[model samples]
Target chain A: SQTIHQWPATLVQPVGSPLSLECTVEGTSNPNLYWYRQAAGRGLQLLFYSIGIDQISSEVPQNLSASRPQDRQFILSSKKLLLSDSGFYLCAWSVQSYTEAFFGQGTRLTVV
Target chain B: TQLLEQSPQFLSIQEGENLTVYCNSSSVFSSLQWYRQEPGEGPVLLVTVVTGGEVKKLKRLTFQFGDARKDSSLHITAAQPGDTGLYLCAGKNGSSNTGKLIFGQGTTLQVKP
Candidate 1:
């Protein structure tokens, strides 16, 4: 069985601080990884997705960026955080671009 | 840009009642999926519809994909409090292989016991 591990279940940081969220997948190789953000209880906004190492596609222009250092390790980072950057971040992995994806426990980041 | 529009952003219903959630899009999709998310958790995939006009049932939940592959619907029979959660519709564009999935705004469903 494949499992995704995402960290810092909850985070509180002051404005202008840096952000680093990590996600890793086990039991799968060369899987498609994605990062998403959700505001309040609404839908998820695609942040970034990677097909392979060093191949990242960003959906929106924002303060955040993503990198896939290894086949199963993906990281989301920001040089400086904004108040609008506060939200629930999720990480997911799928076998194919059109297949069902498995998600990790999301991180709730509060920028004050 | 491809986008999906989900109807009834929020729904509150009584137990034992039936409800249907709809997701529509003008752009064609190769596949559509439905997911359920509880509070403080990530969305879980409930079902995936690949063929147009395809219907799949999981217990009390029935999902249907439009013949054009641009729309889908989810119907829940005998709603239970356990069914209270957020429902999301996601579409996979036929042309994109980057796996750039597009999501609907999502519908929040609350079933009161």
Candidate 2:
């Protein structure tokens, strides 16, 4: 069984502070990874996706970046956090591009 | 701009009632997926419709894809309080295999007991 783990179930950070959110997958190899952010009770917005290590694509221009250092590990980081960066961040993995994705518990970040 | 438009952003119905949620888009999708999300949690996959005019059923839930492959719907029969949650529709572009998904605004369903 494949599972995803995202740390810091909740976070509160001050503006201009550095941010780092980590996600890792177990029981799978070379799976497609994705980062998504959702507003309160709304749909998710794709932030970044990686097919493999060193290969990442950004869906929108924003105050964030993603890195895939290992096959099953993805990290989302920001140099300076903003108030608008507060949201529910989710990490997911899939066997293929068009397959069902399994998600983590998610991290809720509140930028103060 | 939102590529997919979901209707009835909020719905409240009684148990045993039936309801339908619609997700429409102008662009073609190779696959359309439906997910249900609870507060403070990640969305869970309910169904994925790939072929045009495809229909699939899961217990009391029925999923239908538009004939044009640009829209989809979810119908729940005899809605229960357990069915209350936020529903989201996502689409994968047919033109590319990037695997990136575009999501709709989402519909919040509340089934009152």
Candidate 3:
């Protein structure tokens, strides 16, 4: 079975501070990885998706960026955090296109 | 851009009651999926409907995909408090192969015990 791990489970960062959230998948290779953010009372919004290492497609222009360093390791980063950046960040992986995505426990980020 | 609209953004019903939530879209989809999310957790896949006019049942939950593949619905029979959560509908565009998805705003359901 495949599992996704994300950390830190909860984060409190000061405004303008750097941010790094890591997600890794085990038991699968060359899986599609995605980054999503869910604001309070809002649906999950796709931030970035990667088909392969170094191939990332961003859905929206924002303060965040994503990178896939390895086949199953994805990272979401930001040089400076904004108050609006606070939300629940999720990492998901899928075996192929148009397939069901398995998600991690998620990271709750609060920028104060 | 393709958009999915879900109705009854917030629903509160008593236990053992039946309720239905609808997801609508103008664009056709190759596949549609429904997910349930609880507080502090990622959304979990409940069911997937692929063919047009598809009806799938998972326990007491019934899911139906529209005949045109442009809409879907989730009906719960004798809901339980454990069923309370955010219900989301997501679709894969008919032309995309990157596994990209368009998601509905989501419906929040609270089943009171």
Best first by TM-score, ranked: 3, 1, 2
Give the alpha carbon lDDT tens digit for every residue of A1-112 in model 1: 8899999899999999999999999998899999999998798999999999999998899999999999999999999999999999999998865568778899999999
Off by over 4 Å in 1: none
TM-score of each: 0.98, 0.97, 0.98
Write out the backbone clash pairs for model 1.
none
* lDDT (tens digit, per residue) of candidate 2 on A12-55: 99999999999999998989999999998888899999999999
RMSD of each: 0.8, 1.2, 0.7
Q: Write candidate 1's Cα lDDT for B66-90 as tens digits.
A: 9999999999999999999999999
lDDT of 3 at A8: 94
Lowest summed lDDT window (length 10), candidate 2 chain A: A94-103
lDDT of 2 at A10: 99
Please report how far candidate 2 places residue B17 from its true position, in Å. 0.8
Ranking by DockQ: 3, 1, 2
Can you give the lDDT of residue A50 in candidate 1? Answer: 94
